[model samples]
Target: MDEMAHKYAHILVAVDGSDGAEVALNKAIESVKHSQGATLDILRVLDLNSLEYGGAGIALDGERIYKIEQANEDYMLKLKERLLKDNEIEHDALRVHLRFGNPKIVILDFQKEYQNDLIIVGSTGKNFIERLVVGSVASYIIRNANCDVLMARTAVNKSK
Candidate 1:
């Protein structure tokens, strides 16, 4: 492989506050480290459609929903800070994008808008098990994304 050709100029890493997702983010950061011109775009998608109104005899309030959204944003912000604080990578080139929608759609839309060179995501174990189930976002993105996708497995890729 040509070291220069494999350089990722623009990368998008999707995280959902999962340990597996953090591993993927670390992999994306590693790629940016190799390509000095590369830029890292970290995204956290908030799925409002899945928000329950009344479930299991429980009620949710508007204030609670707002708080949830705020918490998600704050989490992403903290992640951005941690990535930037690392001296090995250029902090000025890192960006964080927070969106509310289906994660699959949001990711694909951002890929198209930014023309991202690569998309990195954490692979769920459901793909290997026939009886087990997995969330739809990872499946949808893996099947639909036009650009190259890297599905990081927890054992192989550890968070930095």
Candidate 2:
């Protein structure tokens, strides 16, 4: 790959609150900052189905459910703020989106919707092992997505 050529025009970055996601996001921002032609879209998919059946024994209070939804939204906003404020990634070059569904589908749909030049996703997400046993979201995206993809090793999260 010609890393120096900088051919990508529009980049779609998929973040799943993983530490690896931070790396992917940073990489995308750096690409946009360098390539005047590139614009970055940050996508966070909340797998509502996973949340519902994720085996968290604690029964959800109705307000808690709403809070979880709100938290997801807040996380997206914070991603924008972190990029714009901390990294100085240009506002004009950035956009943030939140989707509720299967991450693999959401990513592909976003790629089609935005016609992204490239997609940057973490190799390991919240459901990495599950992905391994069945299939990884990243793998699914790579197999089905039309655009180029960048898959990092592991996310850098507080848990790790």
Candidate 3:
């Protein structure tokens, strides 16, 4: 690899269990494979704001929150297991983080705290109006993150 080519030493990939996120995770794995001594962090943020609005004005009770958290944990664990089985990377080289807060803020904060060299995120392929209403975490990270951001597009989208 050319010295001029950017080599990420610490990669942070945000995953939400979406197809796009799966693509981003694969991309991160590949990047880490090429970069010596690189570590990969997979993060899943349970957006509190989304949950609040998701209930249509009803606040989530404690039991509901616990259930959601548990489900998120299970999902992350499954993802980790799949990655380990399918990739050559060691178990210790990969870390999974499940956090609560706004997705954008949590991701940016994590990158800053870890001083990650690169951030990988998946594009939801939301239309203009939907993006305007729900907000695009990838777009926000690209505009604000201090490190390099990779917005992994779905394979279907790439053909277009």
Candidate 4:
């Protein structure tokens, strides 16, 4: 007899070009492979507003923002191509989304629009101080997201 398989129709994974996010992406890819007819949605959220600066009013440098978006898009496109080539899956099975907003809020809010049954994220993408100041995205999701959340991690501290 074979054990029952859990088939997830829709899966969402957030990536930020970090080691933790890399692990999460790998897990998401594996999940899409095993679950027949499942679709993997990879999202990378950029906060251009955070780059804005002004003495009194909000100021955004269009040139800088454009450069960042262009670079980010290139990165996402390369990842998408590699995933398609390495996985041997249909092109439509994998979807890439780039949005501008607060990652912590936008990630969970995304489920409302796309209705992802499963959300996978890195254990801690931000550094120690950043996590302290802005808080961990994974922790926020675990507390707020109604759907199932998985924290993918790596043995980066195994040496100690």
Candidate 5:
């Protein structure tokens, strides 16, 4: 970031392995470039509440939970590595969080801890039925965040 202009010093991006998320990340990177030294937080939430463990009453086994958590950590590590290799972001400028909970609530609550000035999320990852039933994460974040929010859509490729 330039010394005097930093419209968004900190940005929070939520991803869910969707095409929209990929675009959102791309947009976040683009925004960070203009903001200069803005730090980014990438959050991925696993919906453990919907897990099927022998019906509904049975608890999810400890070992299974452990493995899932490990997988999430591995994915985060790979993401960090990819970002460091591809972007202008320094290793310390990017932070990844893999949390298990309702995405809407987790994302909303997470930004409070980071003092983020901007929040970027995919426009809609879920289909019509799912979104109708549970509501979309992007909609929730846009409505609830205390800071500026962006509902990122598909990427637009520019040619020279």
Candidate 6:
């Protein structure tokens, strides 16, 4: 057990089903494993802005929304299983949460509620043009989060 890992009693990780996120998740699991009694919170925020709009500028229909929500839930479940299988951490030490809204906002709110000592998030490595149009959630979190932020840089981003 390293001293750095023991510094955080509560760790919050934001996962968006991306490879970078998987890296961050793995780091969070390792930190929790090394830190006795530390808990890990896995948060998946469904970015409403990514959803398709209807003819009148309204959001997708209820049925479509329901299906998307169900799919996201299933993905989270599978993610949890993978985390457990890949690591030796106890199931009770991990907590999973799903929310519908802007990811940056939801993550900030969760951090406030949980009072996490550390926040682990994956860098998406979006190009300048894409970031200008869509905005970068990781950038926003790094600037706004109250706790320590760990940006996991994926191998793909390292080559660039």
The sequence of per-residue lDDT tens digits that candidate 3 reaches over residues 1-160 is 3331357788999988778898899889988776767889999999865766355778888898899999999988988999889888878888899999998899999999988989999987578998999788899999999999988888865543
What is the C-alpha local distance difference test score of candidate 2? 0.79
Deviation in Å, model 6, residue 152 alpha carbon: 1.0
Q: Please list the C-alpha lDDT of all candidates, in the order they appear.
A: 0.79, 0.79, 0.86, 0.84, 0.84, 0.87
For residue 57, give model 1's deviation from the true position in Å. 8.7
Q: What root-mean-square deviation over C-alphas does model 1 reach? A: 3.4
Model 5 TM-score, 2 decimals: 0.87
Clash pairs (backbone) in predicted model 5: 1-36, 1-37
Clashing pairs for predicted structure model 4, backbone only: none
Off by over 4 Å in 1: 1-6, 52-61, 125-135, 156-160
Residues 1-160, model 5: lDDT tens digits: 3531367888989888888898888888777766666788999898888778788887888898998889889998899898878888777778899988998898888899888888988878678999999998898888889998887787567442
- What candidate 2 gets wrong by more than 4 Å, as runs, is 1-5, 52-65, 125-129, 154-160
Candidate 1 vs candidate 4: which has greater TM-score? 4
55-100, model 1: which lDDT tens digit per residue? 6545556798789888888887887888778747777778898888
Give the CA lDDT, 0 to 100, for residue 28 in model 5.
83
Name the runs in model 6 displaced over 4 angstroms.
53-58, 156-160
**Can you rank all candidates by lDDT, best first?**
6, 3, 4, 5, 2, 1
Q: What TM-score does each of the candidates earn? A: 0.80, 0.81, 0.88, 0.85, 0.87, 0.88
Compose the digit string of candidate 4's lDDT tens values, residues 1-160. Answer: 0111264778899998878888889888988887777788999999765654555366667887788899999989999999999996779989998989998899988976899988988888578999889899889998899888888887767563
Worst lDDT window (10 residues) for model 2?
151-160
Tens digits of lDDT, candidate 6, 2-40? 975669999999888778788888788889999989999
For residues 1-160, write the lDDT of model 2, one tens digit per residue. Answer: 3472278989999887677787788778877887766789999888755675447775666796688779988988887887788775668889999887898888899899999989887666547568667687877888888978887665335464
Scored by lDDT, model 4 comes in at 0.84
Clashing pairs in 2: 19-155, 19-156, 19-157, 20-155, 20-156
Cα distance off (Å), candidate 3, residue 8: 0.8
